[model samples]
Target chain A: MAIPKDKMLEMLHSLLLSRRFEEALTELCQVEGKIPGMMILCTGQEAVGAGVCAALRPGDVIITNHRSHAHLLAKGADPKVLMAEIYGKRTGCNKGKSGTLHLALPEIGAPCTSTVVGAGPPMAVGRAFAQQYRGEPAVTVCFVGDGATGEGSFHEALNLASLWNLPVIFVCENNCYAGAQRLEEHTRIENIADRAAAYCMPGVVVDGNDAPAIYTTALDARARAAAGQGPTLIECKTYRWRGHGESDPQHYQPKEEIAAWRARCPVARMREAVLALGLISTDDLSAMETKVDALVREAIRFAEESPYPEPREALEDVYA
Target chain B: MPQLTVGQALNQALREEMTRDDTVFIAGEGVGVSIHDNPMLPTAGLLRDFGPRRVRDTPVSEAAIAGLAVGAAEAGLKPVVEIMFNPFFTLASDMIVNHAAKLRYLSGGKSAFPLVVRIKSGAGFSAGCQHSHNLEAWTAHCPGLKVVMPATAADAKGLLKSAIRDPNPVVFFEDMMLYFAPGPVPEDEYLLPIGQADVKRPGRDVTVVTWSRMLGVAFKAAEQLAAEGIDLEIVDLRTLAPLDKETVLASVRKTGRLVVLHEATRTGGFAGEVAAVVMEEAFESLKAPLRRVTGPDIPVPASPPLERFYIPDAEQVITAVKDIM
Candidate 1:
């Protein structure tokens, strides 16, 4: 299922938006202790979020992980509120509760995010089960990292998703590091998707830098899921440019490897793909960046000006 | 206006709730297929009535089912999931505590996880260590979860209904040993408050604070105590997390003594929590140091002799009460 050029370009726009948004958020986080919590920026893996969410319908659901800003933004969450949430402001997405590690906007079918490595898969499987139970032709996407493959929660969810033939897609954003521990340090499998075979599901590996590959793969997974087929594991081989969290030395990742991955940045790669397809020129791309920058600036300003939630609110929202 | 066993009562509550709301569903192992064709199974008649979709029989994937229930609950469904026994609950703790319990709080009130996790607990069946841990303390320890353990069939029926309708995620611990115990249940549909306590037998000498199947031991001990001059007030703490301290406090204040009992190991059992609360809140009212009749701090043995000795019986409760008195 090839995505139309228009849809591909739209995914490009989303990719750019996600990249710029993270860059801006990272910049703000660096501004002399402005943010409350550590930032796990999904910088290099924008295409995985952009292309996958682009293929999804508005009614479909996604459960993201800690480095979830890009995924949530790509899924059409309000950037201003998401930023405010990280800022611990009352106007934030989760009323100043979730912060960065846990951010969810149920209104956009992007519900709660589980920071535990493999937590999102089970929840995604659950929502997919609900969708199937209700007979709603809605696909549920569970976004995890390569580290999650080492976690039992991921395999547990996969087994259930396959056993029940749930309408779910497991997207492993294989950024290769589980907090300074490389993929080799964690598991023996060369591909996280390969583990899907154990669950009796199709596993596919794609270049995380290629927006078209992600978009087309996501569409195929969604179609298969909606058609009553079981889950598919799509491992997007990507890289995180920064430290796992904000500043602890990234001594584990070799500088050469980081530089190599930087050259294949998803946003830049998507831009070149779109350009080669004659969808846009450098001038149009530059203009799009400017617009994205303005939106990010507006979100930052919205976050900065928003009031911190009242201390008493700590007691609220626990029930109901 | 019907005599119902705990299992029958629970089944009726599940049926009534499922019939009342299409959004409510039951999913668990053997929920669809009753074990040994027991018509009185807690989840009996549910599958045939609600079909496979609503009354799902899951594989032994406790974590997946728990996570699935939490996800479905967040996505606008009332899901009641059973983990055949309480020990398996530890496998699903990540979902129950890390996700379901914390989601509404973490989501900043953006979503409601109207999910109930039914864990059958108690140590009488020689089910061994793995199946015997009553981790109500584990659930009650978590801030975001509402943990309820019903001691009677009526309370089981009422509380299960309430847990299903509740807007928060609830871990309902149904006593395994008490499943066949019969009691009077109301014919009309009703829901009990989640965190309320019931004073099953009011007295003025000593307050016996207990919950779940331990209430049976407390009752038996009370019978022996009544034969003497001792008057024992039995306070059944149906809910653990959002504890009804007020009820326990009032009972303790009136009786002027307390004995907290549970089948869970004594180290970190819900018994300690209840005992501590009475000490903190009703310290002046205590005429004797509070006591606890709980399983020793040891893994429940599978052997009949060891398991029998491990569990607190009527004698233990009586002795604990005597010491408190």
Candidate 2:
């Protein structure tokens, strides 16, 4: 399918917004030292989230993993509430109950993002089973890192999805690292998608830095899922530019490998692609960047001003 | 009212609830085929009635079964999934403990996760430690989960009905030994409120606190003690979490002595929690030191004779009560 000029610009906007949001969060964590809890960023993984989420319908549901800010943003979650949540403020999306790792926005089709590796796929199969059982044409998208593929739950989820022929799209963001461990050290296979063939499903691979390519692949997978053609595993080979968390020195990562991935930055690549489209000039792209920068600043300001939850409220929300 | 086995009563509950609500369904390994071989099984004939869409027979994947229920419940469906055995709960603990139990709390109580994980517990049938171990304490320790253990046919039906309708995730424990035991169960639909203990045999000499299959052992001990001019007030705690501390405390206050009995081992057992509650709230009412009659601190033996010895019997319960009295 040919990408439209408007949707292409929208994808670029999402990619830029996600990149800026994480950049600002990194600055707050390292410089100001205000954000609490472990913050896992999708800094170099903008295209995978932006492209895949852009293909989902409004009623479709998504289950994201620990690196979830990009997916939530691409799914149209408000940065203000998301920022407030990471700030542990009362006005945050989960009322400060869930920190960055477990942040979820059900109203925006992303419910129950988990920090447990390889846990999202089984839950995603369940959501898709619900949609299929209820005769709804909607599909569920599950986002997992390549490290998650090693979990037993991931294999169980894939086998069940295939056996039941449920409408779910498994998006594997192969970022070449599971925590500090490099991908080559953990996964022996050349591609994560190859594992899909064991479950009798199509496994497709795409360049993680190419937004349009991912968008096209995800759109095709979603169409197959909604048509009751069962699940499709789409692996987006990408890399994260930052350390696993803010505390890590990341000495395990080779300096040369880091520079190699930085050279293929998804944000810069998407910007060039958008600029190449004659429909938008360099000034238009610059204006979009300025708008996204202002939005990120507003999110930070709202988070800083929001009040912390009362200590007594800690006992609340345990039941019901 | 009609006499029915515990398994029959549970089947009636599943049948009635599925008929009442379209969203309620069962998914588990061999649930449709009834692999346990009990003539009066809860999942018998469910596949024929609800069809495969609702009565899903899954692979031996406990994590997938549990995770599916969590996702389905979040998406506005009430899923009643089976884990076959309680010991296998370890495989599904991630979805059940970390996800289902905490998702509502993680969502800031905005989402209602209505799901039931039906697990068969107790150490009978010589199934050994791997298959028959009771882990109700594991789930009861979690904050968001409601734990239910039915001792009689009536409670088996009523509690299962209530669990299916509950807004939060409930772990419904069924004793494998109690499946064929016949008791009076009401034919009409009824709901037993969770977190309420029932007084099975009321008396004032001493309080015998128990639940699940241990209720039968408590009754036997009461009978033996009653012949000796000693009475035992038996309090069956149907729900472990959201525990009926009021009922327990009330019984203890009236009896002035207490004995906690269960099949699980002594270390970190739920019996310890009961003792703690009495120590915290009704310590002044106790006439003597309370005792706990529980299984030995060892894995359940596979031999029928050793398994029988491993399980705490009426002799042990009676001895515990006598020691406390």
Candidate 3:
């Protein structure tokens, strides 16, 4: 299925913005030491979040994992508040409580993100179950890393979603590693999507680095869910260019592998594709890059300028 | 008012809440089919009354069951889910503890996770440690959760109703042995506030703090002790978290003696918490060292005789009270 040039441009913009925001965050956390906590970045895996979220509507629910900035950006979460959260500012989406790992924007249908591996799917099932119970046509999208697939929670979630024929899409970003452990070392299965057949759901594998490919797959999954066809497992085989968390030295992964994945950057690929469509020029792409850079800088400035919550605020959110 | 079992009271609460609000639903394994075939158990006729959409019978997936409640609650629906056995709560703890309990706080108080997780607990049926363990302390320790264990039919109905309406996650524990025990339940609908203690019996000699089925043991011991002229005042803490420390301390101050009683094993039991509170707040008023009448620090054995021994009985309560006296 061919995507329109306008939608492609929008996705290209989201890709650029996500890449620029993360790059700025990395600098703040690593060089400047401004950000705190264990922040995980979606450096090279931008296409999966951008493409999949672009296929969804604003009201569609999304259950995010620890590496969640890209998906939140694609789903229209305010980057300024997200950055403020990373800075532990009171202006943050979670009022400095969630930090970077557990940010959520419920108004946009992206509830709290789970830092626990394999936890999002079961909650996604609940969100979908609520949607179905309320007779709403909205679908729920659950994002997880390849490592999450090995969790028993993930399997249980899949079984229940299928058994109930609920509207949910499980998007597994196969970045070839679960933390420092490579895919082969962690899971014996060659294709994570193949496990969907065991649960009697459609299994589709897409190119993780290819935005159009992932968008197409996610669109079909969303449609199937809308038609009451239950869930579909879409595995996007991608790679992360950075370490699992901010503190990791990444001695486990080879330099050559990182360099190779870096060469296949999703942002550059989407930019080139947009340029090839002849709807935008190199200058236009450059202008877009400059704008995205400014947006990231503004978000950082907002976060830095924001005040930390009072110590007593920690006791505030424990109950309703 | 009518005489009803705790199970019947719980059923009345569920039925009333579901009828009052369309958003309230019940989900669990065999909730709809009544697989246990115990008419006294809640959800006995719920599937037929509320239909499958509200009274869902799910697979034996505790984690998913709890997670579903978390999501549903977050989505603005009030979900009251069940874990067949309290010990099985270990499987569902991640969703209940990590997600439901923390989501509201983690959302910076921007969200309210209004849900209830109903669990059947207590040891006496020889269901072994896995099915019979009373782990209220596990949940009560968490900040965001409200833990409740009701001993009477009226409190069961009233508390469950309040829990369903509460705009936070609540862990409601029902004793398996109390399912058929008869108590007076009001016919009209009513709600009990969480985090309050009830003075079951009033006396000044000794204060015995307990809840759930352990209340029966305390009451039985009180009867035997009354004949001996060592009067016992009983305090039932309906809500464990947001503990009614004022009530507990007041009772301790009046009696000038205290005994914490529970069926859970001693080491990490909530009884220790009660004892600590007394030591900290009522130390000057205490006439004797605080005593804990709790089960041994060991897993509940499956053998009937051994299980009976594993559970703290009225004899233990009486002995602890006498020792303090």
Clashes of 3: 0
lDDT of 1: 0.88
- Candidate 2 per-residue lDDT, tens place, B86-200, comes to 8999999999999998988887777768999999888988888999888888889998999999999999999999999999999999998899899999996878999899999
Q: Which 10-residue window in model 1 chain B sums to the lowest lDDT?
A: B33-42
TM-score of chain B of each: 0.98, 0.99, 0.99
Residue pair clashes in candidate 2? none
RMSD of 3: 1.0
What fraction of the true Cα-Cα contacts (under 8 Å, chains A to B) does candidate 1 also have? 0.83
Identify the CAPRI category of the predicted complex in candidate 3.
high
Q: Candidate 1 clashing pairs?
A: A126-B68
Global Cα lDDT for candidate 3: 0.92
Candidate 2 error regions (>4 Å): none
Candidate 3 interface RMSD to the true structure: 0.8
Best by lDDT: 2
- For each candidate, the alpha-carbon lDDT, in order, equals 0.88, 0.92, 0.92
- What is the Cα-based lDDT of residue A154 in candidate 3? 95
Residue pairs in candidate 3 whose N, alpha carbon or C atoms collide under 3 angstroms: none
Clashes of each: 1, 0, 0
Write model 1 residue lDDT over B114-162, tens digit each, in one string: 9999998888888898988888998999988999999888899999999
